[model samples]
Target: MTAPLPPLVRLPLLALLIDAALVVLFVLIGRASHNEGLLGTLVTLWPFLAGLVGGWLMIRAWRAPFSIAWTGLAVWAATVVLGLLLRVASGQGVQLSFMIVTTIVLGVFLLGWRGVVLLVGRARVRRAALLATAKRMSTAG
Candidate 1:
């Protein structure tokens, strides 16, 4: 069997995969709403993908991939802003209404998952603490 990846490598890889999946999902939903097919969805995905790469670089997102403050906010902002800029440059429409919708939708997609992860992490920590406390009490008594 193959060896498992170290945390340094594994965390960033997982973060990138999750971020890419969310971006693709955003594109897929938007395309479906317009009754567009796969090719059109992929065509629309390029600018957003570019923005995601730019965001990852800008935030050095791998450092704290799961942190909402470090990764989630920066990634969301960069993806929406840079994505629209690239889209505009590519002669794609960037109307105000579309921008607003894109911002809200992408924000929810990107930040929502991070928020869930944060809650779960906190819960796990709390549970561990409680378990440790109980073990100590039983041993002492």
Candidate 2:
């Protein structure tokens, strides 16, 4: 059997999965707000999902899924644009208010997690550096 992948390798894959889940969450929340049936999930899901896939493919997101500026922005843009376009082509409503709401909410969902990850990673690095410096000083003194 192949050895388990390292955490570093697994992280990007995890990020992709998170992004997809967030997109689905966005759809579900909107549908619920509108009193739409859960049975109609796929009808609402495909457009945003397609846009999400397009975003991932366009940026080769696996290469840098942790990057907010790189992966997050591109993914947000593609998902919103394509989702809107597909919604129109599919004869769904596309009011200005809905467009604004979708853009803001998806931006927060897609990019917010990445921002949190970046902050956590930075904190860990700083803590490690401080510990190392303290150790060196103690040993020297």
Pairs with steric clashes in candidate 1: none
Q: Give the TM-score of candidate 1.
A: 0.93
> Which parts of model 1 have CA positions greater than 4 angstroms off?
1-4
Native RMSD of candidate 2 (Å): 1.8
lDDT values, one for every candidate: 0.91, 0.91
Per residue, candidate 2 scores C-alpha lDDT tens digits across 1-141 of 999989877987798789899999998888887666866777888889999998899888888898999889999999999989998999888899989999999999999999999999999999999999999999999
Which residue pairs clash within candidate 2?
Answer: none
Cα lDDT for residue 98, candidate 2: 88
Q: How much does each candidate deviate from the true structure in C-alpha RMSD?
A: 1.5, 1.8
Q: Assess every candidate by TM-score.
A: 0.93, 0.90
Q: What are the runs in model 2 whose C-alpha is more than 4 Å off?
A: 1-9
